[model samples]
Target chain A: MRISVQLKDFDIGKELKLFNNGDTNIGAVVSFHGIVRNNSEKSLMHMDIEQYPGMTQKAISNYVEMAVERWSLYDALVIHRHGKLLLGDRIMMVATAARHRRDAFQSAEFLMDYLKSRAPFWKKEVTKDGYQWVKSVLDDESALERWR
Target chain B: MIKVLYFAWVRERIGVPYEIVETQSGTVMELVEELKQKEPRYEIAFSDLSAIKVAINQELCEFDTKLNGAIEIAFFPPMTGG
Candidate 1:
């Protein structure tokens, strides 16, 4: 499994190719990408992301391990970026590989849910209206209930 | 000395990203109380305990969680990640 929390942008095409590793046992791959959005009609100037340096990686890796064990995943890759991001910029991505599509799909969803609810990253959005810290939506936290 | 870190609005109001705190507080709340007593900025930043979250050594935990040799502590708001 690969987990990266960095300031630099990643190449999805390259990441996928590297993720496959020519492993014939893996039959399915499911991936999800998260990008910066401006739902308020171009008002958003940018977003600044902050994270705990030591804890972020460790927390994500623990969840990835759980995903692999539960889904019997062949491989998994998670990349979450930190620092300044503008509208439409890819903020994060998660890919899961398993022998079956259901396992891959479900694991990817699980990872995404975990990231939304439990990850340490914090975002501050600067918009034409004003600069404010983004609050965690209640719905997102509730989304984790399904996994339990 | 424990390393205390803050993020987002907590850091903005506290005026520092991290600090070395010397404390004998047994629980997170005790430590918070001590910091709150140290400066008004800390008091303001931590005014609403319900809005803030705490972590001991990077693992999210309750305010009543014991310190017990923990080397690092962090305070922030609910995560808005991913």
Candidate 2:
């Protein structure tokens, strides 16, 4: 299990290779990547991501632990980036490895669901008009409860 | 003294990133009430409890959680990251 909270973007291929390390016992691997999106109504210039330094990594570890405990995973990994980001930039990624695809896929989704609302990150979108904090969506909250 | 930290808009509105608070408040809500009495900015910043989330010693907890012997507490808006 690994949790990384960083400011720089990660290499997907390199991270996955390191996560699994070509373990022959692991037959299935699943990964999810999150990208910054543009505001449809406004021209988004950039986004500033604020996070609780010590707690951000702590929160992510808890979520990853939960996924690892509930699933038959060989490995679990999460990489989240903070600070300034532009549209289409990769913001985060999670990968899960298991003997079969089911556990890998479910746990990967479960990790993502938890992080969407539980992780200690706040995003402020800057546009031509102004800047505004991205509000937590009700759907995102409900998404977390799905695995429960 | 308890370390009180704020993040995001909470930090922006409160006008300070963090402060060492000396208080007799027993619970998180009581601590909030005490801060609210300090000035109008604290009250304005914490007007909506639903919009805020609290972490006691870096662990998420209810607003009614006890503050006894706690070293740190953080308050921020609901997280929007994934």
Candidate 3:
């Protein structure tokens, strides 16, 4: 149950190793990485992400706790980056481990879905044409609503 | 006293990030009405509650919840981040 909102990059291998260390009971581990896209229909060049310091952590923690309880996961990790990010930069990561693949896979999806819709981060797109704030997707919200 | 925060488009429209306000324990909707009466700026800021989302203690919350010992209140648009 590790959750972090950091400004630095994370090593997936290192994180997975830490989760798997001396744990023969752990059978499956699933991880997902979200990366910044190179383009948007709005001609976006880059994105600036902003988050509330104390609130952001609380939000993620709450979501992670729900994922753990609902899926019966062994362990989970959530790491999100902030500040100016360019195309191809890793924005966030979700890793889940459990004795069986079902729990690990479900937990990983749960974390990503919640992070996508529930987190308190804002993304402002910078484009060659101009800049604009990204709009919330109804589809994403609907995806997270299933777990709630 | 509770700290009220505005973010993103709400911050841009309201012209400030946060402010400290003194109010009796009230539901979030009641507080919004109280804030709307404080000044014209607040009136404009909270004119359209439909577009705003409320968070009490950082979790997404409803307006009918009481703010008895809540330390912070956040108002922002529907989240659009990943």
Candidate 4:
């Protein structure tokens, strides 16, 4: 029900509290948080994320709509950050609410899978050696085929 | 005139984020060929079309797709988001 593409960091606790408020019929809330990993070959300085402003939001919204319809979710929230991020920083989060745990869990994973490869955001890893654009992994693409 | 935009390394190679182009190409592939003839930078960036992805008016499409009055076209590599 909510999609946010922002530059500022988000408070996980606060976001969950807001999402869970006044929802009496919701039995399960599942959430996934993505963080910047520091374990690359070279020591990472930071990550530079670039996105196509208008297109990114539209792509994410379409994915969210698909998740809601497929899982019959009661509510869903997606918060993705753009710009620079340091190691250990939260990059994005997806939360799904449903009457049962199955729908909540599956929908969150589905959203994450689609967002990883389908969204317009591109990441450049700035390491001790230099900068390089992160390549799209075959595993990520294969993961999405299961939902089809 | 169509607005052509590039992202990530494509932008870095093209040396500009976007440009206005006037062309008579009828398909995406034709437009790319026209661009490749413009300069060496474009040729180098578009050398390996297999690694490139194209979008017509913000919607993903194949290279053979017709350019039917599309106002914008974008070129970038596969996305690595989230």
Better of 2 and 3 by lDDT: 2
Query: What does candidate 2's lDDT look like per residue over A1-148, in tens digits?
Result: 8888899989999998798887788999999999989897758999989999999889898888888888877899999999999999999999999899999999998888888889899999999888999999999998877787
lDDT by residue (tens digit), candidate 4, A1-148 = 9999999999999999999977888999999999999744758999999998888888999999999999988899999999999998999999999999999999999999999988888999998888999999999989999999
Candidate 1 wrong stretches, greater than 4 Å: none
Superposition error at A94 for model 1 (Å): 0.2
Output the worst ten-in-a-row residue range by lDDT, candidate 2 chain A.
Answer: A64-73
Whichever of 2 and 3 has more TM-score, that candidate is 2
lDDT of 2 at B44: 98
Compute the DockQ of candidate 2: 0.94
List the pairs of residues colliding in candidate 3: none
DockQ of 1: 0.90
| Model 2 CA deviation exceeding 4 Å by range | none
Poorest lDDT segment (10 consecutive residues) of candidate 4 chain B: B51-60
lDDT of 1 by residue, A2-90 (tens): 99999999999999999999899999999899999985666899999999898899889989999999999999999999999988899
Better of 1 and 2 by DockQ: 2
Residues B9-68 of candidate 4 have per-residue lDDT tens digits of 999999999999999999999999999999999999999999889989988899999999
Docking class for candidate 4: high
Q: What is the lDDT of residue A45 in candidate 1?
A: 94
